[model samples]
Target chain A: MSSLVALLHATRIELLRTLRDGSTLLMMGFPVLLYPAMIWGLTQAGLYIDEARDRETLVLGVADGVDTEGLGDDKVQIVPATLETLDAGDVDALLAGAGDGLELHYRAGSPRSRRTRRVVEDRIEARNTERVDAAAVEKGADAALLAPLEVDVDAIDDATPLVQFLIGLFACAFVPMSIIVSTYSPVVELFVAERERGSIETTLCAPIPRSRIVYARVLAAALLGSLAALGNLGALWITVLHGAVLVVEDPVSLPFPGPVVLGTILALVLSAALLVAVLMSVALSAARTHREGQTLANFVLLPLIVPSMAGMLAVISESSRDVLFVPIAHTGTLLYAAIRHELVATDLFVAVGLDLALAALVLGGWMATLGPTSLIEGIQRPAWLARLAGES
Target chain B: MIEVDALVKVYPGHPPVRAVDGVSFEARRGEVFGLLGANGAGKTTTLRMLVTLLSPDGGTARVNGHDVRTAPEAVRGSVGYLSVTTGLYERLTPREMLVSFGRMQQIADPVGRAEQLIARFGIGAFADQRCGRLSTGMKQKVSIARALVHDPPVLILDEPTVGLDVLVAQTFLEFVETAREEGRAVLYSTHIMSEVERLCDRVAIIHEGRIVAATSVAALVAEHGTVEKGFVATVNGA
Candidate 1:
């Protein structure tokens, strides 16, 4: 009961401390407002890709006396020019007409050149198939009799292009980014910064136990991080809407179902709590100064970012019990699935169980490491020098 | 009263260091006991052990009848500690810092207690200002107010006047006298001979992690002409 009171006071102080640091506030709040605009601009990128794929064919320079009737798309204009002049840069491709075949040439590495080559080749192939069909018709044979097999395909995928993109980008990329921006300074400020500035000694001298102090700081960080995450998602929502109007005409919105959204938020809370405990313990363990704490917190980003990036990119999109066992990646995958409306009972259950277990373990480790003596000797050197110093 | 017996602390390293080696002292009710030493002479370490910041490897300390090792919470609840290294949270206002400390000490009506200390310390002028923006003297005043808000019966101050201007330092010295008069046992550590002469009823001179002398200032002056010379003589005699 007494520990609870001490924790409340400590958490209140920690939260107020973070609110006052101008840099921390800016780092957390700006992304929410700016990212939406950036997301809305992605529509232009899609338009570019679509335009690139279906462009009108440029003039295909042909040798004189080459019969070019019905050879390619009607929009493609045939021109009379020597292969060298055309190939040099005047046309999309140069064609040397043979008796019944053609040789096509284009620039070696350009994407436009590759597109021209594919178009010309496809035109010739289509012509060849047409000739075969005409010959068969003249022989009084049905064209459908040419092949024995008949195949039909019925395809269904509920995810829209934008929805897929969001799900793919969410897990590894967005979650960890939110964690980093939201919790980094506060974690350092609460634990390592206190120790560095020598205020930790004063806090330790209080009648409250060190465990309560650790609890208060961790909870405070988690609460702030959760707020940042919700803000990020909210910004992402508005941005996606902006992108819909600008990038896709009448793009369908894929909102997570009400329960699913709440569950994802709860998952974010758990993952953030786990991250805070781990980072604070690592920071307080390895750092003696705020600068050193910042460096250590950056190192923590390595593990958080890599797996989450993989998940968000759909490099590992398949959900399973095994995936749920992983820490940050699990949170990312579960959140992605929930957003895509593909989340299932087992995925959420496993995610909750796994994250809670990890949080407990990390928090327990932090509690074990916290003490007056450890703070007095928290770390002898910067984390970077520990290896070098150890060898010496 | 604060009682300490043969307290020891050995810091583990390439070659272990005995930071405080079997030190002992006592500060009785209504007395200001001074522990004087050079830097790294175990004065802070001994005080830290008493305040329950660092645990002793051997022996024990008791503040207000609470055993430091077994009943450290009670010891902390009973004693207020101040030191040069003890700092205020820079982002919090002086009032917030004091109220937070009061709450930690589980004071009823913590805000009211903080208000009283704020007025007593003349902190009302800038009590709402964040500590980081405060002048050094103002910060010192806040730190003092924070320590006193809990109204603990014992005070352990380690160089609490290290950076204060002479005038503010004098104000703090007067407060110490007031605390002593209220029958609060004060264990004060410093190397400043003048403050020690004015405040301490008894003096313990520590050298190289061990106590070399423990006596009243008058007896030391009778033997060595002054507490400053007595400190030099005691440290050198060891």
Candidate 2:
């Protein structure tokens, strides 16, 4: 009971410290706000370009002998002009006279014009195919035999492109989140700074068990991590909702479904747990200096980020199931898959189980190494050099 | 009371290093025992063993008759330790930290105890201030309050007054004296000769992971002319 109290006290202190640290707050909250804006802005810009390109009018100047009727519709306008009128740049003036906008020039039998003429040529091919089918029908051959096999392409579900995009966006956010966990200074500083300031020694000397001290530290880190995760979730949800409002007219409304919401919350908890375990292990194993410990703790984040990146790219490619099982990859996959309405129960269980297992292994390692002797003596230089050869 | 018998700690390497080489000592109730050594002299290692932070490679250590190796909780429950580096949560106010630590120690009326300690330390002015924003002296007071939160019977302070101003160090020594008067067994470790002379009832001079000499500070000072010279002669084998 006393030990439990000590652990809680220790954890509370740690959490308070992290919350008050301005740099930590900035490091965690900045990216959460910034990343969504960047993603939404870039996506909006891309959509604008696509819209513009869709409305762009292509002007074509046909050779003198080509039929103007084949051009079809107002999608591409065609005008006939004499070589003398075109060569003198008079076609530009002529189009202005006609108020038809810009004019593209073509010469008789020119290969450059021939390549440009391919766009109109596709209609000719369709007409030729119709003629060929007619001829085959007259010969009593099956018209179906003349046609190639048809492929029916269906989307996995009714998930809108916007939902798919959000999934991808969420996956990208995980990279920053993972980086936030690994690089956050307070996590490392909690132990390393205390050791440097001589406070760790004071606590060690106190009538408190080492395990209690460790538990307190871990609990504190976990609490801070959860807070950070919550902040991120709120920022992300708001950004996503705003982006959806802008791009998805009459967006398909789903009350953040219970399972998906539950899964996300669980993922956040497990992520925080894993992060705390890693942070504790690094903090415990590091030397007394805060800088050294910070560097070491930051190193562990590299692997976590790789999985997130791979997951992001894999989502774009709709890659295989193997990608979904890799640490941070699983979080992104589950989140996106849930958004897309394609997540399976078995897959969710697998992802949660894997993350829990990883957290356990890391926490177990930290717990095993929480003895006072290991923590204090583990970082110290050897002692024999202090002795004069014959002094002992 | 604390008893450390043949406590040894070895780190494996190309050639193993013995951090604490068969160190043994005893501190009776209400006594202030000083462990003296230069840098890397095994003073910290020995103190750590007594605190149940490090496991001894050989022999055993007990606090209040509870074995540190087997019954660490009992030892932890009875001992208050302060290392050279003050481990404090810099974000918490001294009062909050003390109260929290008291609660952790399962002390009754922790908040009330925290207020009392704050008033006793004359740190009430800064009681509500974050520890990180406090000066070094204030931080040390917070650490001391945290150590005493549970009001344990044994106090193990490893270079507690290190890096403090003379005035702060003097006040800390007075605090140690008061702890002793309250019947707590205090183990103080340092390389500072004057502190051992002024504060300790008995002194153990350690060298190269072993205690080279052990005696009352007054007797050693009288015999060797000064505590500094006595420490040097004992540690240097002169």
* TM of chain B, each: 0.98, 0.96
Listed in order, each prediction's TM-score against the native is 0.79, 0.74
- Docking class for candidate 1: medium
For residues A1-392, what per-residue lDDT tens digits would candidate 1 score against the true structure? 45666677788887999878887787778778777657645655655653564443333422212233345544233454332343353433222222122222221112233233343345433343354344434444455543211111112234265655554455346755676657776777777778778887778877777667767777787777777777777677566655544423344566555875776656755565556555655555666676766666666766676766655544354543355666666666666666666677776777677766777776676556664345333655544565432322
**How would you class the docking of model 2?**
acceptable
Task: Kindly give the stretch of ten consecutive residues in candidate 2 chain A with the minimal lDDT sum.
Answer: A148-157
Candidate 2, residues A1-392: lDDT per residue as tens digits? 55565566677767777778777777667757785887689667756654443333333342122233344435233544332233344434433433222222222222122222332233223443354345444544455544411112222233355654674467444633544473455566566667566556555655566656665665566666656665565566556655554444344454464776656655644564555455555444544565555555555666556776777777767772777577667666666666566777777777777776776676566457554334433354334321211112
Q: Whole-model lDDT for model 2 versus the true structure? A: 0.66
Q: Over the stretch B1-238, how does candidate 1's per-residue lDDT look in tens digits?
A: 8888998998887698998988988899999999999999999889988888778999888889999999988998998889998899999999988888888888888899999999998999999999999998898889888888888899999999998899889989999999999999999999999999999999998888998899998899889999999999899889
Q: DockQ (Cα-based) per candidate?
A: 0.62, 0.44
Which stretches in model 1 have alpha-carbon errors above 4 Å?
Answer: A1-6, A40-161, A164-168, A251-260, A315-322, A369-392
> For each prediction, how big is the interface RMSD?
1.4, 2.5
